[model samples]
Target: MKFGEISESEYNEFEKNHPLGIFLQTVNQYHVLNERNWDAKLVALRNDNNQIIAAAVLGSRKLHIGRLYEVTGGPVMNYNDQAVVKTFADEMAKFCRQHGGLILRWIPNLHQAKFDDHGNVLETMNQAAKNNLELAEFQYNEPQKVENGHYSKVALSYEFIKRLNGLNAATLEKSYSKDAQYSVKKAKEFGVTIRKIPYAELEEFHKYTTATAERRGFKDKPLDYYQKSFKAFKDDDKFLFAELDLKQYVILQENEVKTLADRRQQLVEKSEQHLSKHRAAQARELEDQIQHHKKRIVRANKLITRFGQKPVLAGSMFSVQPQEITYLFSFMNDEFRDFFGPYLIQDYMMKLAVERHIPQYNFYGVAGDFSGQDGVLRFKQSFIGNTYEVLGTYTRVVKPITYRFVRLLKRIIGH
Candidate 1:
C-alpha cells in the first residue's frame, strides 16, 4: 500500500476501476472549480500493484470569516484496507496543509454523505472524534458549524423502483402520497405523453429548470455550471435527465383514485353544462378545467407505464460505492399543471428504477421545517423512503490563530 498524491487524470483512471464508481471522485470537479476558486482544489493519489489505487480531491483555501479550508465530495479510493484509509487520512491533512498556512481541514465524502446504515458516516465520525475537537450544534443563518465540518441528509431517492407491472394508481399514492399519485393519473388521461428527455437536450432542461427555480424562489446554478459538471463526469453518465410530456401533467392525493374519478365527473358535468354556453374564452376555460380534472386520473394510470428518452433507466444514474442517488432539480410547465406533467416524469423515473432494480431514490435536501416547504416534504415523504435527520456541520480546528482571525474578521465585516 504505497501512497502519494497524484494528478486528476491519473486519479480518474483509478476511479474507473474502483469498486465505487462516482462522479465526485473525478479530478474534474476540483479542476473546474479552480477556474473560479483556484486555490480550493488539491489532488492526492496512492497505488497498489503499481496501479493507481487511491486518489483524493483536496479542495482548500475556503473563504470564511475565520480560518477555513474546505474539502468536499471526496478522495477517490478503494478503501478495502484499514492501513490504507489511515495512511490516506494522514496524507490528506498534510496535502491540504501544504496549500495554506491555516489549519489543515478535511471532511471525507463519506462524512458528508448520509445513508441507510450510516456506517461510513459513523466510521468517519469516529475517526474525527479521535481528534481533540469540540462538537458543533445547529443554529440559524449563522453557521453553527464551520469549515472542516461535515454534514449529510438521508431520504428515499427519487431513483427508487418498487414494481412496475402491478403498480396501480393506489400503489403510486402509497409510494409518493395522495397529491403526487393523483397528478400522475391526471397527466396520462389528458393526452399528455410521458417520455424521457435525452441527455443531448440537457441544455434545454437546465434552462427550464433554472426558470422554475427562480419562479419558485430558490437559487440555481448557471448553465455553464451544469455543462462543466456534466463534462467533468459525463464519461460515466453520472448526471442524467428525463423530461415530462408537458401535455401530460397531473396532481392528486395519494391513494385517491376515487377522488380523481370524482373530480373527472365534476369536470365533465361542468363542461356539459357550459357546452351550449358559447364564448371562446368560456369554451377554452371549460376545456382547460376539464383537462385539469381528467389529467389527474389519466396520469394515475401512466404511473404504471414507462416512457423515457434515455437509452435505459440505469444509464440515467451514476454513483460511487452504489450509494444514494439524489435529484438535483426537476421541472415542468405551469400552463400544463392541470395535466400533472412533473409528477408523470417522476413516476417514469421511478419505474425505470424498479425495472432496473436500483436501490434508492434520494429527494436530495429537504428543509426540516419551513411553512412553504410542506408540499415538498410531503412529496418526498410520500415515497415511503426512510427519512433521516439532516446533520448540521461540525468543524475541526487546524490553526487556532487563523480560525479566530477569520471569525473576528467576519464579525468586523458583519458576515
Candidate 2:
C-alpha cells in the first residue's frame, strides 16, 4: 500500500460509498476550515492494484513546535485489515514529519466494543484491541471513561426499519417512549409547526441558541461558526425549527372542545334513552374525553392571551449526512419546555429520513457510561436506538518532545 495526496473530486467519489462516510470528511467541511485559515488536504492510500483503499481530509494548523495535523471523521477504510492499516499508519507518520508537523491526530470510524442499553460492554473487538497500536502511537485520553477528547466515543443512532419495522408515523410513534410520544402528540395538538430556518434568519436562531447554551451551561460557538456550517450544508442539510402559533392553538383547542362537548351530549342522550350498560360505558368515555379537552382549552386560551397571534419559536435543530441523517445539534427555549418543541422537531426530521429511505437517524454523541444518570442520554434513549461504542481518537507523535510539552500545557490548563 502507498499513501499520497488525492484530488478533492477523487476523494469525494470514493467517500460516497465508504462505509463510515460522514459529512465531516467531505469537501464542504474542508472548505469551512479553509475559511478559518486552516490548510486542508485530501489524501488517499491505494492498494497494489492501484485502487483506493483509504482516504482522509487532513486539516493542518501551525502550532508552537510545528504544524498540527488532524483528520476529521476518518481516513475512510476497512479498519479490520491490519496490514493495510499498519502501512498507512507508518506512511502518515512520515508524511507528517516531512511536512513539519508535531503530531498526526486521527480517529477512525471503527467500533471498539458494543454496549447494552444499561451500558454493559456486550461485545469487544479483539482485532481492534490488537491492531490499535499498529494504527497510532497513543490512544484517546479523555477523563471520562466513555468519551474521547473532543468527541463522543459512544454513538446513539436509531435503526429506523429494524426498530420501528415500518415507515408510517403511527409506527414511528409506537417506537418512541410513551413520554416522547405523548409530547409529540401534545406539540401537534398545540399547533406546533416545523420549517427550515432560512439562512437570513439564522441570527434569530443564534440568539435563542446562545440563551439555551447559557441556561444549559454549555459553551456556545460564535454565530459565524454556524453561518459557515449553514453555508457548508446549505444544499443538503436542514436547519429546522418548531414554532407555535398560540392563537391557532387556541382555535384548535376550542374546536376540539366543541367536538367533544357534542359527542358527550349525544352519548348522554343515548344513555338516557337506552338505559343500557354499553351506553353507560360510552357515556363515561365521552365525559372523560370532554374533561381532557376542557383542560387543554384552558391552557391554550392562557397561551393565546399571553403570546397573542405571533408564532413563537420553540426550538431549532440541525442535521446533515451521507449515509445517515444525524441530528447534530439542537437548541430549545427553556420557557417553552412544556410545548415539547424538541420532540416534535426531532420527530419531523426522523420522518423525513424515513421518507427518503435513509436507514439510520443518528441522535449522535452520548456518553458510554450510562450508570451516571445523564439527562441528555436519557432524553436520547427515549427515542429508541442502538448504542454503539467507538475505539476513540488516536495520535502519532511526529515530534515527541513537542507533543509532551503540549500535553503538559494542556494538563496545567485543565483542558
Candidate 3:
C-alpha cells in the first residue's frame, strides 16, 4: 500500500464516494479546519489496483516539543480489512515517530473502534492491538470536559429510512412528539414565519445564528465564515437555517399547521376504530400508517399558507442535501422572542424540510456529555430526529514532551 498526501478536492471526492463520510471529512469541514485549526495534509493509501482504498484527512502544526498531527473526523478505511487498516496505522505511526512523540488523533468515519465512557475516540491504549501500532493513554476530551481527558461528540440519528420520510411539513407535523406538536401549535400564536433567507440574505442569517451562539457561550463565526460557506455550498440549500418573520409568515404557517394537525388527529381517532384492528402484532405498523396519513394532510395545509409570501420575505443560503441539513448560523432579536419567534422559525424549518425532501436536520454539537445545564439540547431533542453521539477527538502525539510541557504550563496557569 502506498501512502501520500493529496489535495482537498481529492479528499472531498473520496469523502463523497466513501459511505463513511462524516461531516468533518467533508470539504466544508476540512476547509474550515485548515483555515482555523492548523496546517493540513491528506494521507492517501492506495491498493495495487491504484484505487485509493484508505485515506485520512489530517491537520498538522509544529509544536515546541515536535509536531501535532490531528485528524479531523477521518481515516476513512475498511476496518474489516485488517491488512489495509494496519498499513494505514503503521504509516501514521511512522509519521508520528518521524515527528517525535507524534500525536495522531482521529475521529474515524465508521463504527469500528471501541470507546469507553466518552463515545468513539482514538483509543491510545488499543491502537497497537487494533492496527499493530504502539500505544499511549487515550486522551479524548474537549475544552469543557477534558479534565483528565474527557470528550464527547454529539451526533444523533432517527430510524433514518422510516422516520425522516415525512420529508416536508405534512410528514414533520405528523411525526412530531406530542410536546413537539404542541411547540408547533405554540409558534403560530406568536406569529412566527419560517423561511430560508437565501444566499442573498446571509447577513440576516448570521444575525439569528450569532444571537443563538452568543447565548450558548460560543463565539459566533465572523461574517466571512458564512460568506465563504455559502459560496462553496450554493447547490445545497437545505443546510441553511431560514428566517421567519414572526408577525409576517412563520406564525401564520404554524397556525395553519396547528389547525391541520387538529383536523388530522380527529380523523385518525375516528379512523382508529374503523381501520386495521389486528390489535397485537400490527400495532406499531398501524400507528405509523395513520400518522403518515395525518402528516400528508398537514403538509397540504402548509402549502396553502405560503402562497401570499413571495415578495413578503427576504433571502438566504440553502443546503439541499437530503439527510443532513445544518443551519450554519442564524440570528434574531431577543425582543421579538415574545412571539416565541425561534420556535416559530424552527417549526417553519421542519415544514420546509418535509416539503423540500431534507430529512435529517442538525443542530450541531450539544455538549454530548451533558457538561452543563444547556436548554438547547432539550430544544434539539424536541425535533423529529433522535440524538447521535459522534466519534470524539483523537490525537497521536508527535512531540510528547511538547504536550507534556504545555500541559504543565496549562496546569500552572490554572487552566
The TM-score values for the models, in the order shown, are: 0.58, 0.83, 0.61
With candidate 1 superimposed using the best TM-score fit, by how many Å does residue 313's alpha carbon deviate from the native?
A: 20
How are the candidates ranked when ordered by lDDT, highest leading?
Answer: 2, 3, 1
Model 3, 134-240: lDDT tens per residue? 23333554433522212223222111111355355455666766777776686564334555445676676666666666665556667777766666555654333
lDDT of 1 at 174: 63
Off by over 4 Å in 3: 7-10, 34-37, 93-102, 109-170, 185-191, 198-208, 237-323, 327-332, 338-341, 344-360, 368-374, 399-415
Q: Judging by TM-score against the true structure, name the best candidate.
A: 2
Give the alpha-carbon lDDT of every model.
0.48, 0.72, 0.54
Candidate 2 residue lDDT tens string, 252-354: 7678778877887877776666747877787788778878867866776776677565545565555555576777667876657788888888898878777
Q: How would the candidate models be sorted by TM-score, starting from the highest? A: 2, 3, 1
Model 1: per-residue Cα lDDT at residue 289: 59
Q: Candidate 1 lDDT, tens digit per residue, 1-415?
A: 5556566567666655554444455566665676555464445544556665556665554454323455444445534455555565555555545555455433333322232321222212333432311322111122232112111221211121122334553354566667676766765654445543445766776767777677766656677776665665454334444334322333333224455456546655777555453544554665565565566546545543543211111112232223334455666555345545556556666665455444555555444332434555556555555334322233345556776787798889898
Task: Tell me how many residue pairs clash in candidate 1.
Answer: 55
- Candidate 2: list runs displaced more than 4 Å: 129-132, 135-170, 264-298, 301-313, 401-415
The CA lDDT at 288 in model 2 is: 85
Query: Between the candidate structures 2 and 3, which one is better when assessed by lDDT?
Result: 2
